[model samples]
Each structure stands twice: as C-alpha cells, then as structure tokens.
Target: MSNSHYDTSFKGLCYVNRVRMVKPSKSDPYRAVTLSVKSGKRVSTEGKGDKPEFTIPLDCKVVGAQAQAIFDQILEEHWDDKKPPVISAAFEVGDIYPDYYVGTRDKNAGKTVPILKGRLLKLHDVYVKGERIDTPVETADASDADTPAAAQPETASAETREDRTVDAVAEEAASFPSVVRLSKDDPDFEERKARLKAEGYRWDRENKAWRRPAA
Candidate 1:
C-alpha cells in the first residue's frame, strides 16, 4: 500500500483477468476489477517506470443504477472465463482509497493501494504465445436502449435531467471545448445528430459531421 498517486497514461495490451469482490456486514458484495499488463511501462508525473507488469485496481462497483448497469454491460461483454477476452486499453491512473475489503492479498486489512480507475476502451482477440484463441468471442454490439436506459428504472429520467444540465452548462460556457463528431453517412446519422443537437451538440461544418462533448 503506497500513498503515491498514479497519475499516468497506462496504454497497453492487457486482460480483464478477474474481479475482486468485497462483502460488507449485511449487503451485497462490491467488486473491483483487476486489469493487468504482462509487460508495460508505468508513466507518472515524477517519471516513467519500466515495470515488467502493471496491475491496475479499478473501482467498478458503481453506485448509481445507470452507471452500474453500464459497468455491468462492460463486464458482460468483455469478461468471460471460458474464452478469455483480450483488449487494448487506453486509460489514465487516478486515485486509490484505503479499503478494508480490497487488495490482492489480505482482503479485510484495509490496505491503501494506488488505484487506476479506467475502462476497456478497445476489445481485442485473446492471444497466448502470440497465437489467437480459436473460440470466437461474441462481438455483437448492444444498442443504448438495450443497456443504460432499460437496465434501470430511473435511467431515462436521470439521463434526461443530465442532458438538460449538460446543455445548460454548455450554453453558459459557450466556448467550452466539449465537442465530438458523427458521419453523415451513418445509418442513423440524421436522427443521431438531431438528438445530439438537443443535448448541446452542434454541427462542425469543417469536420463534415456532428459534434458533442467528450462525455
């Protein structure tokens, strides 16, 4: 357990090996996912460490229903034991708090470790000894309606409020650098752009697409 902050970019080939769960006195256990890179360098403000392997502990047991559903979707899509799913991850290390039920060893000790909160930004084929696993992983893309909105009862209302809040903030900040793009050729391009417009997104004529916040 170290007090050092892990504020660094951790981009590498890694695996969502497993989830570490912690139980409370009388509640469902909370789970934290363990992401590991067999060989990679840890980049921090102090400097970069040529660490052979970097294990990142992320807090995935989110509180909000919408968020938890998203996290669950991520897990269901990428984490499977029968056929290990590999991924190319791009993330930055954040904070790791002292917890009584977390850590590789001594689950109840309340150890403080540098936690790297991140997401599986990209999914890749599982490779062992530089060979791809034959068992095809399910790459079916799930729609937004299939997840967050439907996963929780409060998701639609919560999202509507959130969208309004973001819209208000974006308008007040006017110049805020929070924009993204969508191609006009996309199947739902028009509908998507219209929805984004209502959510504070705008058309970037220069980019030939719609734009919105990174969030």
Candidate 2:
C-alpha cells in the first residue's frame, strides 16, 4: 500500500471514556486530544435471519486550533456526567494509515491486530442524546458597542464564512483537471502548490507538474 495521505469522512459514536487530552512532555507543551470513534456496518451471517453489526474502531488524534476548541467544549459539557455521554459526530479525517499492535486480550493475546489511525481534521457536527451541538458561531459581545465601529475588525461570522468557504472549495475542486501544472512565475505559485499537495497531489518531476487521478 502507498504511504500517501488522503482525506476521509464518516459519522461515528464517540464514547467519553475513549476521549482524553494528552500532553507528551513539559518541554514540548503542545496539547492534543485522542478520540476513539466507533463506526461499522451490518453483515448478514450465513443461516441466520438477522444481520450482525461489525464495529471498526478508529483511534485518532485531534489537533489544530479550531478542532481542538470544539473537542474541549465537548469534554467540558459531558466529561463529568453521572451517565457518560456517547457523542455522535460527523468527522473529517486525514492522513490515515494502517497500523497494528500486539493484542493483550483473550483469543488474540500476543498477536498483532490491525487498526486504522488518522488525524481528526474537522468535526462537522456533534450530538448528545438527540440534540445537535458543535455549532460554530461567533456573536458580537455587548461591550463591542463601546468600541468604535471603524476600529472593529471586519470579518464574516464564523459559521457563515466556514460554510461558504467549504462550498467554494468543493466547487473549485470539482473543476480541477486530472493533473495540474504550475509555473513558478505565477504570483500565487507557492500558495497554490501547498494547497495542491494537501489535496493529495504529488509532484511529477518528469512532467514538472502536480498530478492526482480524478475521483
């Protein structure tokens, strides 16, 4: 299998016990949250009338400012409840890789068990019980009235801006060619190159271009 990174999105159940903050060391004070998302499908068993559900567990880490903030809010809301909340969320993950570790439980003791691991890039929506959470909105504070309107930064609301940005990006991506070439002479060459790489395009040395097959 190739080691190239790719993006994936899914809906899953997140148990409180499987979520926590991690600080590697005092020297490297960067913080991250680990989330275990359970997702799967049902499969019919031979000679059985019912379909048995199979669970696929993805152990992922959430980093970045926006994603981490969302994670923190979820923890703060339900971390200490008498009945731990099982959160349902839509997750966008990236750079997924196949990994394995020695199993310590019965039957699979001392044997390697495969696992899927990735970076939690974004959380589209979250729910506890049946109520939706994770709404991304920034409202103007009452104190803002005291400040001069001209001095206040001009920016679109978070939720509206993000939604439009996602839609724009999706529309642009759909118009992309199977392969893209860039010239250093372009003013935005560097920025476009970075964006292309993040979108799974690889530099083709021979062709002097970035290339990726169309989905």
Candidate 3:
C-alpha cells in the first residue's frame, strides 16, 4: 500500500479517505480520484502519465483494495483491460470513487443489506411487486420497550384494540355531566388538563370505558 501523498519531496506513508465518486467518461476511462493531497482538495483530471482522469460518485460498496488498486494503476500508465473497463468494481452515485452501486449487490433480497465499513445500508418502506414487507398490526408491545428493532413486535392500531372504526375518535365531552366552561383567567387550560391526567386516569374494565373523578 504505497502512500499517494502529493509531497514530491517527502513521501513514504500516506492514508486516503473514500469520498464521493462519479461515472467515468470515454476520454478519461479510469475513474477520477478526488484526493486531499497537500495541494488541497482537487480532482485528478489527468490520470498518471497523460491519460484522462475519470469522474465517478462514491455511494457504492467499494472495497479498500479495489479503490487503492484503481488509484495505483491510473497513476502508473499501465491499464491492463483497455476497452472502457466494464467497471467490475462496485460504484454508487455519492461514492468517493467510481466503484459499485450500494444496493446493486443485494443478492439475498431483503434478508440483509451489505455492511460497508461497519455501517449497514438501510432501505426503508421497502416492497416488492406491490407486496409490502412491513405489515400493519396492533397491541404488540410498547414502542419504547427495550428490544432490538428487528425482534420487536409490530404495534397494532387503536382501532384493533376494541374493534372500533379506524376513523372514530373517543372524546371525553360526552361523559361530562356538568357544563365545564373555560375562562380567560385560566389561559393555560390545556396544561391543567394534562397535569390532572398525569396524576391518575384509569379505565374501568367493568364499565367498558374510561372513568374520571368529579372536578
């Protein structure tokens, strides 16, 4: 692993970071290497020895080996496979180099996503052929329960609780016996109601509904 540091005078060991990459062009077949050499952040327009530099995005799962090798080969004037390297390497739109697409190598479908540098690639709201993967449920468990998200039970909607209509709402107004009016003096009426709720509010299983103390 030769350090590609840009200090022509002093050079021995250098480390490179994988930033974003772009697609390579015909003139510059080899992907452009965006490096932070001593000259600051600049794109290597011309690959080693007069060959045009490539420009590719870096969001794909490009292994450290592939990236480093690409850089080395381009810098030396020795491109093995001539006709526009089919790009066997992984690349993505935002990857640091022209490598592989992130989701392009998902061989096992939704079972697993590739772990790149200890980071998992997530595809949320995923589905296949109009079939959704995440199902709708209710009363599985408290959302905040200490359980791995993968193993956590799916939550059920409130309507599934009492077989109530999904669009229905149970307002406490119907249960009130007296006219509970609000006054300008108590501008923070909602706060008082919440405080009272925190104190204690329970449902009576026998009554089949909620029960509140007289105000």
lDDT of model 3, residue 93: 17
TM-score of each predicted structure versus truth: 0.29, 0.46, 0.15
Clashes of each: 3, 0, 27
Q: After superposing candidate 2 on the true structure, give the runs of residues whose Cα lies further than 4 Å from its correct spot.
A: 1-17, 25-52, 138-215
lDDT tens per residue, model 1, 18-74: 544445888754444565654555444445333344654554332222322333334
Prediction 3 global C-alpha lDDT: 0.29
Model 3, residue 189: displacement in angstroms? 82
Best by TM-score: 2
Over 62-146, each residue of candidate 2 has an lDDT whose tens digit, in order, gives 5333454455455544454466676666665666788999999999999999887776656656776657885544333211323
Pairs that collide in candidate 1 are 179-212, 180-211, 180-212
- Candidates' C-alpha lDDT: 0.43, 0.56, 0.29
Q: In model 2, what is the error at residue 118, expressed in angstroms?
A: 0.8
Candidate 3 vs. true structure, TM-score = 0.15
